[model samples]
Target: MNLLNCHQINELLSAYLENELDTTTTLTVANHLEKCLSCEKELKALTNVSNLVKTVIREADKTDLSLVARSNKINSLVKDEITSKIKATENLVLASSNDNSIKTSQNNIVKLNLRPKWSALSKKIFLSLAASVAIICLSLFTITYYATSTGPLLSGVARNHQFCSAIEISNIGWHKGYPKERLLQANNINLPKLDTLGVHFSDLHPCKVYKAPFLHMMYSKGDKQISLYYGSQEAVNKFQEKFKTITPNELYLHQESNLQIAAISTQKNNLWIVAGDLTKEEINAITSELAINSLSNTEESKLFH
Candidate 1:
């Protein structure tokens, strides 16, 4: 077979570089390149330009260009000579010359198909990552809210108070096991007798609220019930330091539709909470009476020093 002219060879160069030509035509082109410096240089330039276009497309994420704008940019980059060369590679498949010189252009079309697909895949990956981050942040927020709001550290004790009040009779064994005398001797916290105030003590029990060991006292008069809780100064301090909500020697009131709670921080490094099914005034009076009694006891103890 005769060797094709430069013009015919030029048309087949793109197909030749992409390996889209038949075996015979591929060998013919390779043999021609051995003798022709100009055609060989042209092939090298085409490879470099094609690689450059791919690099720019891959790095599209670094820029703020829209998809259309990016596509336009790529079109511009492959314009004139480069576009003509790519177009030549595509057309080589359709060439029906007498020599059967070319193969299919499916690979070239597949490369062109990659441009938009790559951008879309990158966007989907980024969006999936963003959604995952958002979900993690939301989970963290929910955990923190419950930890501070309704967890055992804070207002959760109100639920404990309500539950204990509902079944005060079952606590008889607890009261028998931990009497008022054992409480004062062991924990150094004397339970005040509220008989003068018409709220009579019914039971005393040792219980734990989170990490704090508390002395739970049940007092009632008719339909009114009050729960008094006391914890040591050291245990209370650990809770206060971590939560930052409790302050020693301060009063905090918490009320719901059916339940009312009052928390008192005593100067002696102890915590006291009064929760009951009573009016706010009643709860306030009980807290105040306890606070005043605690103060009087502290004063009496100081007389010896």
Candidate 2:
């Protein structure tokens, strides 16, 4: 096989590291990397990121929840730490690699010391699922964002996402049964009758999305799961105007990027926000069934349009 250039090898480096390439392609990359110093450096960068992810996972829920740090600033701090740690490994690698003149280059050997240096890993999220699982598994972590126009709404959404991600990364909230029961017991959150609504909840936790107390419920059906939030009337209305847009129904539906969101007036006209990998119809089904049952069950006054 011909020698693979930096660009070509770069294309396959991630897959090579993940052992996703076939025998022939794998050999081609390995053989090329054995001779190509530049591509090897690039591969090391990816590996460092992976190691940082491991650090994050090890320090899960250890993030110093500053009410002020923005996501980008947190990222810069994390990268600087990685770079500093990488520097500390340079002389160690140089001392050894220099002895073996055959394959030695200016680049340092990649180390896998995943000791938690920073208070938390950066909030950056890796997107490609095929090449790496570290970043994907760790999930994105962002400081509270309350400066936006829709402060409560956006803040609530982001907090909800963070809580759900934490639960997911903890190896809970995926399977049914005892896991959900344990979470429910641990969090002491309220659980509504959702089984009749065709949505089987797996985990329930008492979470506060930017000061709005919600009983966050996680439910899975097949390959997808969603986070459903139940909050008081004031807390729900802070996100948006309520009871003004319903037509022939009592629920308001919203969505974004495969995120199905819907809010309805519950028994006390409290808010119910449902969002996740669910479809639009699925969101409507859960909200409608819940709202109808809630009304019937509580004998609450209807203020629908």
Candidate 3:
């Protein structure tokens, strides 16, 4: 047969082997197979290959149990390894949590221990400041109280004796008047000739007119000038008693009208006998001088005489 003619016969043979051919085609293929030795050999070889494939499938089916067992073992091992890793992570987290809790507790304890000492130091500082403030306030109060009580008495003295002049006139002939000059001659007390000690008459005031050792003495000191009737020791004592509230260590001499007279001794023994209507200003000035102790006893006698 021609090769082209064998095309259909090959299809028939393939179909016949699978039992897909009709009865007529099966007989035709069988008849052709009996006559065609090449086709018959090809069919036999295809059959033998199919049988061998079936045998291999049967063997694979039989060994499937072994494969399933090995797969199950591998799955179990992976699960165990995963669980162990999870447990190890959980233990590490627990340990870290415990350490953090312990650290926080320690910090709290340290703060608590320091709190009392800090509080005590704060209290001590506050109390010390309070005490210092209290002491300063008390001292200021005492000073103010004393100044208020004493200020008025000093002011009153200044107001009463506001008209006197502050000048010193000693052993001057013109101050004695003409008739008093005759009395000075009779007493045998030689009087100095009248001359200004560059001191003005306005600077002189009649503080006191004295007899015996000194007579008709009109004393004048700064801002105060007055004429006094200085008769006897009895008169001076009567004046002192009337002004009994005068300050101690203050030398009281005489008074003319409302004016009061006092003398203080300096270091030079000089007497600063101030007579004033403004007694406070005068006394303040005198006290300032006294602080330095400059007016001594010798200076006191020269001013007094």
For residues 1-305, write the lDDT of model 1, one tens digit per residue.
35687777778899997889999999888888888898888889988999999889788756655877879888888787697887785665344332233333756432222234478899999999999999988865554433322323334433434422222223332424545687666877667677778999877766554546667787887767778877787656654554465432334444321445555665456777676666667766776678666645332111111
Which candidate achieves the best lDDT against the true structure? 1
lDDT of 2 by residue, 1-305 (tens): 46667798899988988899999999999888888888889899999998899899868746656524677798999999999987877766666553433343368435543334442433233234433675544342222223222223344533435432222212232322335555545433346566775668765654554455566777766656667776676555544443355432233344322344555555555666676656657766776666655535433334333
lDDT of 3 by residue, 77-181 (tens): 999999999788666555665353333354443111213447888999999999999998886555433322222422443332232221122232223233654
Model 3 weakest 10-residue run by lDDT: 192-201
C-alpha root-mean-square deviation, each candidate: 22.6, 31.2, 34.6
Q: What TM-score quantifies how close candidate 1 is to the native fold?
A: 0.37
- lDDT-wise, the better of 1 and 3 is 1
Which of the two, 1 or 3, has more TM-score? Answer: 1
Top TM-score prediction, candidate number: 1
Lowest summed lDDT across 10 adjacent residues in model 1 is found at 296-305
Model 2 TM-score relative to the real fold: 0.34
